[model samples]
Target: MGFEEDALLAESGLIIAPDPESARLTRTITGTDQTGAARDIRIVEERPLTIFLNSREIVTTMTIGDFPDYLALGFLKNQGMLRPGENVTAIDYDDELETIVVRTDQPTDFEEKLAKKTRTSGCAVGTVFGDMMEGLEGLTLPATPVRTSWLYALARTINTMPSLYLEAGAIHGTVLCREDRPLVYMEDVGRHNAVDKVAGYMVATGTDAADKILYTTGRLTSEMVIKTALMGIPVLASRSGFTAWGVEIARDVGLTLIGRMRGERFMCVSGEERLVRDADPAAVAAEDPRSRRKGSRD
Candidate 1:
């Protein structure tokens, strides 16, 4: 199936753009099963996602479309380009070129921020760590923990979620939730951009992540871990996997990390105590303790 391009939101909830002109493209075909029997394809859209800083073009990203604003803020946060307390002055979109302008309190120096580009297993983007430890301290999140058992449940349920990924297989999905129920489900070509969309949507709708759970379809990377931490979300889950630094950061900030969530099982790389595990009722009720209940990993 061909991937769909994004268009402006109309009266309806969904919109598709007109056939665009020729542009550069990139992709990688992934083998899903260990036996190489199962196959899943990935079409990477490394298109330019430009962000203008206070009306001046500062960055252009090769990413998928949804959540451009959140992607912008996430970019600024990592570069130490913006502070959490700084109110976003304005956001303007240019439909013609698909460019976004992000306005903030004061002008910033883009050169120094760009010098910290680092490569990842996924991609070589950029990163910065000035005052990161101090910044983590400023986040005041709710004491409520996202139970680990709930992590398994939520991870399973997320696969069956009503999201764009279920419709468009090419896109990576990002969701923001409170406990078990998800509120925002956004999709993009890049996992990073999907996350940014959640942040942007939450910001636009005045939703707080203090007690929320952030879920993604992509592997948990250090960039994602920090983004969720800055948003004040206590938990992060992914059906895929995680990088070493991603787990370390989550542990340092007292964050719960759940991954490889298949139906009833999940890998708890950090904050395992947060899960509330209970015996399977069907199994306990029956003679066999191994009697498993049927479930769909959403």
Candidate 2:
């Protein structure tokens, strides 16, 4: 490997990184290219995962089959079905049936909440049940000051990390980072699923989000903003662009929202006051062309 690859490998010592080589996560298929030459390419595998809270069957999500436990807990937590500090007695996953059941100590019911499902703009058609906005009524993220040096370091490290998105064309990634180090990296067909996995990991491991930053390889939408704020994460940065409501909500909740983070450039649309501009942008190395992922050009 070259010096750049070696540096990338050294920086990608995440607690949970992508497993692109997993046979269950990808499939090879033959197809013809532009020149009509035969080619075999690997594509990500999407499977239906039905999540149940107690006896109540929640929404069925299409995801890249991995980390079903985290996905389930995160989904329910984000949807307001699982409140914080709720006693989760057991979490059972039956891969053969493609189902995961989360049992809580208290009896649970969300029949009416499930009836008011709102379809989000996330890929694979993400659904939010029962007033996702209500969760933000009294929500305020910590005014955590983020250093520009940390942001630059995180962007360079995460962009060059080996991931399923670099392996397959269709995927989104969300990384949980502290300062300049990436901790858990999760990818899925939908960006929502990826974020949920990160959230689940936080909940499962009891990791605090107040001092952390979230990096995504997806657009900054309202759903993304809400989830990050609800998780109590102060900063959300993306290599892509943003939506109007996403910026508005981030500003309202004191959450730092930075987007269009490529190479030595980044735009902080919300919580700009929290950023300590300690890094000289000109001194930072430009993003390597070969490290660019899918949809980065958009």
Cα RMSD of all models vs. native, in order, equals: 8.0, 5.0
Task: For candidate 1, write residues 193-276 as lDDT tens digits.
Answer: 667666665554455667788878778878778777877788888877788999888888878888876555568787777766
Query: Taking the tens digit of each residue's C-alpha lDDT, what string does model 2 give over 160-215?
Result: 88888888769998998889888788899999999999888777667778889999
Error of 2 at 61 (Å): 0.3
Taking all chains together, the TM-score of candidate 2 against the true structure is 0.94
Give residue 140's lDDT in candidate 2 (0 to 100): 85
Clashes of each: 8, 0
Query: Between which residue pairs do clashes occur in model 1?
Result: 67-197, 148-274, 148-275, 149-275, 156-298, 158-298, 159-298, 160-298
Residue-level lDDT for 160 in candidate 2: 83
Strongest candidate by lDDT: 2
